[model samples]
Target chain A: DTAVSQTPKYLVTQMGNDKSIKCEQNLGHDTMYWYKQDSKKFLKIMFSYNNKELIINETVPNRFSPKSPDKAHLNLHINSLELGDSAVYFCASSPQGHYGYTFGSGTRLTVV
Target chain B: SQQGEEDPQALSIQEGENATMNCSYKTSINNLQWYRQNSGRGLVHLILIRSNEREKHSGRLRVTLDTSKKSSSLLITASRAADTASYFCATERQGAQKLVFGQGTRLTINP
Candidate 1:
C-alpha cells in the first residue's frame, strides 16, 4: 500500500478558479508537508505541519492555504488560480522529527 | 536560500556501471537525506546520514556525509535501467525541522 496518497491525481481548472488537493498518509506519521514542483522540476516546500500544528511556512503566495484536519491529513487549497500556478504538487510525511520523508505520487495540476 | 545543491545536473551511464551524485549545502545540518524521483512521479526516500555519522549503506545505495565540509554523496552501484531517475539531496539544517532540497541531478542508466 502507498504510504502517502493524494487525491485528484490530475486537475484541470481555469484561471480565477479555486481548487483543492487532498492528502492522507497511512504510515502513522506525525509530520506532513506540501511541496510544489515547478516546470523546471524544482521542488520547494510550501508548508509543513507537525501533528496538526503549523510548523514551517515558506514564502508561498497568500492565495495558497494549507489545512490539517488531523495528524494524518493535510490539504492544500489555492484561490484565484493562475496559469503560473500550473505545476505538480506533492504531499509527504514522516515520523515526528525524523530525517526521512515518504512522498505521495503527486498531483499534476494544469490551469488553462 | 538554505538549500542543498547537487552538481553535474545530469549524467548518463550504461547498465552495471556505478552512479555517483554529490550535494553541497551552506550551513550546519542535523542530517542529510537522499531521494529518488522517477519521471512524473513523487520522490522516494533512499537513505539518510546524520551529522555524527560519516557513512551509511542500504543495499546497493551508499551515502557519505562530511559535516565539516557540509557536503554529502550518494553512490548507486551496478545501476540498472530502472535506476534512471532524478536524485535529490535534502539537508535538514541545524535546528531546522524541515528539509531544504537540492536542485537534483538526473541520471540515465542505459541497459
Candidate 2:
C-alpha cells in the first residue's frame, strides 16, 4: 500500500480561479505538513497539523488554507490563485516525536 | 525562513565517483535527516542522524552529524547515474512538530 497519496498530480488553472488538493496518509502518523517547492526547487513549509489541530502556519498568503478532517487526511485550498502560486506542493506525515517523514508525490500547480 | 543551508548548490561528477554535501543550521536540533528528490517527484527519506550520533551508515550513504558545530554532512560513495537528484538536509527542533528544510544541493551523476 502507498504510505502517502495525493490527488490531482497536475493542476492547470487560470488566475483568479480556486482549486483544492487532497492528501491522505496511511502511516497513522499524528502530525502532517504541507510544503511548497518553487521553480528554483527551494522547499519551504507552509502549514502543519497535528491530530486535526493546526500547529504551524508560516508566513504564507491569506489565500492559502489547510483543512484536516482527521489524523489521516489533510487538504489544501487555494483561493484567488496567481502566477506566484505555480509550484509543486507536497504532503508529508510523521509520528509525533519521530523525524522520519513519508512524503506523497507532489501536485504541480500551474497558474496561467 | 529555512533552518538549514546546504553548500554547493549544484554539483556534477562522473559515475563511480564520490559526492559529498554539507549542511549547516543555526539553532539546536534533536535530529537531522537527509532526503533525495528526483525531478518532478516527492522527496525520499535517505538517512537520519540524531543529535547524539556522530555518524551513521546506510548502504552506500553515510551521514555524519556534528551537533557542536550545528552541522551535518552526507556522503554518497560510488555514485551511479541513477543517483542524480537533489539532496536536502532537514532539522527537527527540540519541541517542534515540523522539520525545517534547507535549500537542496542538486547533484548530477554523469554517465
Query: Which one is best on lDDT?
Result: 2
Q: What is the TM-score of each candidate against the true structure?
A: 0.97, 0.97
lDDT of 1 by residue, A1-110 (tens): 85899999999999999999999998999999998888888888999998899999998899999999999999999999999999999999989765599999999999
> What is the per-residue lDDT of model 2 for residues A6-112, given as tens digits with 9 covering 90 to 100?
99999999999999999999988999999999998888899999999998999889899999999999999999999999999999999877768999999999999
Model 1, B31-110: lDDT tens digits are: 99999999988899999898999999999999999988888999999999999999999988888778889999999998
Residue range with the least summed lDDT across 10 consecutive positions in model 1 chain A: A90-99
Standalone chain B TM-score for every prediction: 0.97, 0.99
Which docking category, incorrect, acceptable, medium or high, applies to candidate 1?
Answer: high
- Backbone clashes in model 1, listed as residue pairs: none
Q: Measured against the native two-chain assembly using Cα atoms, what DockQ does each of the candidate structures obtain, in the order listed?
A: 0.82, 0.81
Candidate 1 TM-score to native: 0.97
DockQ of model 1 vs. true complex = 0.82
Error of 2 at B105 (Å): 0.9
- The true-versus-predicted C-alpha distance at residue A111 of model 1, in Å, is 0.9
Report the lDDT of model 2 for residue B52.
91
